[model samples]
Target: MSEFLIYEQQGPVVTLTMNQPEQRNPLTGNTAVAEFLAAIDRIDADNSVRCVILTANGPSFSAGGDLREMKRQSTPAVSEMDIRQEYRRGIQRLPLALFNLEVPVIAAVNGHAIGAGLDLACMCDLRIASDKAKFAESFVKVGIIPGDGGAWLLPRIIGLSRASELAFTGDTIDAQQALAWNLVSRVVPHAELMDAARELAGRITANAAHALRLTKRLIREGMHSRLDTVLELSSVFQAVSHKTPDHMEAVNAFLEKRKPQFGS
Candidate 1:
């Protein structure tokens, strides 16, 4: 609903674009964070939204925290505790919301994803970057740390050693280097970024919505969960999937050598 985020729905796929190019689409300010949370809520409530492509319309995906806003808010009256509380109630919400959302999200990194912006991409289920894109876990450069769940999310995506190097050095890496580090799933030409992202979303959205959501949950749980626990959860989800009309249609259509038409 906020002008900071542009939400465009096309059938089962929704493209959430960060629209403030002049500011390089910073995520710190109240408006962007609130709009992002609201967008997640809206997507979660709409079953028709099977997939999401999070992209930014700018030379930078996001410059991370709004330093201008931070300067404006940084007053002698505001204690360290106040700043901590602000983080908990502010940009931190974006990672938590994206992580918990049932629908699959693909981050289409069109340009630079620095600091918390890098973590934002990590929060998504998948990431695709444009050839011109760059990434950095850059909090250390600004004399701060990754306060928006990057410490947890980054390690999970690219392993501890790589994540540690990025977070500690605050070095920027190009799209190819990101792909080599397993930070992004793929890299495309800048002009083709959206097309590649949409194609990936289409492949995901073609499946049964229920199965996709449940499988995503299973993957998320499996990340920090024991094998036996994940297996038990998977068994339950599998049983539930078996009972869905879409599952039956998929099986039947496979046997008949025809495309399956899934239903809600």
Candidate 2:
């Protein structure tokens, strides 16, 4: 029911759209942030939802934080403590919530994604961008860092040297450059962005939901562990996978030379 975030369900794929196109979908507002977080929580609670496509309907995907709002909160000479507290309540919690989501998040960058907008895209498991899309870590130009987890996510995606250059210069990169740098998984013409994202979601939706969740958990958490630890973790995941009806059906179908039908 929130005006800021709109949710649409398509079988196992849930699409969450930023509805404030007039404001370019800024994430800094308390209402928008709370609504977005609530929508994500709803998606996580839905067992039938396996994937999420994050996108916006505006010419610019998002203009990042609403600097005007920030200024309004600061004009009264708000203390550092007040600003920090506001950030914690409104901005800092975004990345933490995104990271803890149980299902995969796919960012369909339909247009410009600057600063906090780029951070949101970075949080997703995969990014599919349109040719018109532009990405920028605009913090340096404004005398700030990419506050909402961009500093951590950028290096992991594109290596330290590139992340440093982008963070330091605050230069905008085109979708092609983003894809070449592996910041985005793929880039297509503006007309094809949603279709590409939907196709990818459909592919993921065809897989065993339980197996996919276990795989995602293993990959995300196990990548930082040692080989022995990864193997042990995989063993645990395999045991869990074995308990799923999908696994049994897959095994039976393989023996019968047939395709398995997965339950919703």
Candidate 3:
């Protein structure tokens, strides 16, 4: 519905493509952030939409931010308080929208993902990269920190040591290196990137939607939790999952020696 983002639905799979490729889909303005949050709201509120694939439509997935826009704002008299208050609302809400999506989000990294772009990909549950894709946490190079969740997401995706190395050095790594470092789930040829992403989404869509949602919630909350706390939380969600119709059908199908037919 919005020009800043394009939302497409095919069966149970949904795709949210960043449409401002000319500006490299920078997350600088209020419009882009609102459009992205709207996309997430659409995915979360639609029960028929079981999976999401995030991608862009140009040579670069995103160039982080509009350099010219930042340049225009840079001035000798600009106070720190003025800068923070100006963009604080947007910077705070964008990451929350990305992280709080109920359904699983897959990053279809098609090209260069630098600075905030890399952080956006890291927000997704899984990442599928095109052969031409390159990832970089270039915050340090620009005299800034990972303002958007890059500092938090990177270490969790890769190990602490590797994430530290990449963030500290601000090095650019190719798709293959990302796969090797476990940043992305897999890498496909450039021609097969979208197909591979769709295939993965399809596989996820074939399962019971309620179960998948609960599982996602479990994993997200369990990542930073202690063993005992996670165990308690797991039991809570698993009990709720067991009460779903699909769970009953799955049990009956197992007993009858046939495949479960999950409802949409």
In order, candidate lDDTs are: 0.92, 0.87, 0.87
Task: List the candidate 1 regions with Cα displacement exceeding 4 Å.
Answer: none
Judged by lDDT relative to the true structure, which candidate is superior, 1 or 3? 1
Candidate with maximal TM-score: 1
By lDDT, rank the candidates, best first: 1, 2, 3
TM-score of each: 0.97, 0.95, 0.94
Q: Model 1, range 1-264, lDDT digits (tens) per residue?
A: 477999999989999999999989998764889999999999999988899999999799988999976785678877889888888898888888998898999999999999988988999999999999999999999888899999999998899999999999999999999999999999999999999999999999999999989999999888889999999999999999999999999999999999999875
Worst lDDT run of 10 residues, candidate 1, spans 68-77
Cα lDDT tens digits for candidate 2, 15-134: 999878888999886477788788878987887889999999889888898988767666768887888788888887888787778688899999999999998898889999999999
Please estimate how well model 2 matches the true structure, expressed as its whole-model Cα lDDT. 0.87
- The local lDDT score (0 to 100) that residue 176 gets in candidate 1 is 99
Clashes of 3: 0
* Model 2 worst lDDT run, 10 consecutive residues: 216-225
Candidate 3 lDDT over 168-236, as tens digits, reads: 999999999999999998999999999999999989998898888878877887777898888898898
Off by over 4 Å in 2: 223-227
